[model samples]
Target: MMTKWERLAHELRLKEYTHLIVGPGASFAYLTGMTAHVSERLTLFGMNADGHAALLLPKLEASGVPRSLQIHVYTYSDELGPVEALKAFASDLGVHQDSRVGIESGHMRIFEEHALRQVGITHLVSADEVPMALRLIKDSHEVALLQSAAQIVDAALTSTLPLLKVGMTELEVAAELEYQMRKLGSEGTPFGTIVGSGPRGALPHGGPTTKQIEQGELVVLDYGALIAGYAADTTRTIAFGEPSIEARKVYDVVLLAQETAVDGVVAGITAEDVDELARTVITEAGYGDYFTHRTGHGLGLDVHEYPSIMKGNPLVLTPGMVFTIEPGIYLPERFGVRIEDDIVITEDSAQVLTQFTKDLLIVGD
Candidate 1:
């Protein structure tokens, strides 16, 4: 009964891969439940074909490794330098000059790559596929964690919505939302808390600012909470006082598109098809250009994962895959409307994890 990682190692060996190296990121946290910070110091998780695992970390961080992994750890101090330690660890893992090793190109530093080359391991290739394949499907335990994180954020959003005022600055709303999330037991925010009001909402990646929220404007709250290393992302648009007819039309169209996309999350559907469904809905309403970004992105240990929901990507939907279904319409020089929710594919259909109300909220002055 080998674990998923152990089975991955066995498969890599059959494929002639000598070792798969991982740095501190979602993949490392997924493989090992222990969270380690990515820093200037070198820390790596190496797995061999025989399911043997090793950790090369700073001497101070050695204690962070969980006892359950049973991984061999090699530590180096500042005085000794990390190159020699990497050499010894590579030898211990049986990586040689001709060994076909796999490394995470994005996370592994050039310093470590050069160190491996110096130590005679020259056949290093990208190992991103191995972990991506393993992480796309969420196990029961992982699903539970994701759901729990979603619940925490939903509760926080529900509680904070009432505290939003016409005079409150976007930054103030963001701070209040974060406070509620932490009070509800979230470890921290997955990304920067977004509270874009009025015309700022038109900017997809807009952050909170000192500008005060005004009446008759649409405010977008796009935020998430992190718990147990899993993340939850959700977005909802609130209308302070009565919004303009144009803003109302945008909100209604976007809401319909978002709901339609969520209902389209059945097994066997292509990710592109889902994106197309939402795009068609908005496009038919004459706001296609306003729907600028992709339909959505996958989520789990990392906020953005695999199986991107966008046109031109042929990835099929499968059970155990979790992602967000967010469709937005941003009208430049005006306001924007976005509705987002976390969803996980079931055997036959999909389950929405975030329970926040998607109905347009009209708050009075």
Candidate 2:
């Protein structure tokens, strides 16, 4: 566990990055299992190609860093500032202007970049891929966290769906759903809970609104639960009552696409091929144009990760890889439908981690 950064350091050396600096975010927590508090203070996890690493943090946050990031801990007081500590960090690590430093482009802020520059390290590069490549594969611990997150989300969505009422506002539904998740033991939400109702469902990422849900309209409930820094994304579209024939037909198409895509997931298959499995179904059903967005995305420490399940991405699926298989279709100004499930690639096949039933449900009547 403490040696995780050793792998990243080796990758950096292969890429000729003499040192790698990570900031406080999912990437940081991925390595440390500790979330660094970031405000105006400068805190960083630095690793050199020699596999030596240290943490430079505010004195207040120093105690919280784990041993993984504590091989050499340097602290700066609020009054003294981080400059002096940073100087010593660079000097001890033998980092200089010529050292090829890399930073987490995904999470490192501009101010953090300037701080690194102030330390005389000139060859700073964006090496986000170096660590993400390691994170792409799920270890036993990460898989357990993801599975637990899915279980909590499943329970929350299952319990909350029956509470949706026709006249209930989308915000009301979202609130109930989120509250259930918390009561069921989720740490927090990975992203904003989406409760798009009726025509609002046409907006893929549209959030909950004050608009009231209506009878005979489709409601898109896209949500997830976060646990131990891992998250699961699941979306289910339900009809308040009997939906229009057109809406029903569209929903069926999306369901077919989503299920087929998930079933096709297997080790050695390309990510784009899995995407094609779903896209082809929708396209042949004459609803391809309405199906926007990629088939799905990788899910883990962050809501989105590597091995994008989209057209043109040739990333090969492997055992222990987890991602979402969500195919959606939005008929503008009408109702939309999306069915999503979290999937894990097995040795020869795949398993759907999210146990939420994808069947079209008639509810909120």
Q: Please, what are the lDDT tens digits per residue for candidate 2 over residues 110-209? A: 9998998887877888898888877888887888889999999899988987887789999999999899999999988999999888889999999998
Provide the TM-score for each candidate, comma-separated.
0.96, 0.96
- Considering every candidate listed, which one attains the maximal TM-score? 2
lDDT of 1 by residue, 316-351 (tens): 899999999999998887888999999999998999
Residue 141 displacement (Å), model 2: 1.4
Error of 2 at 137 (Å): 0.5
The lDDT values for all models are: 0.88, 0.88
Task: Report the lDDT of model 1 for residue 131.
Answer: 80
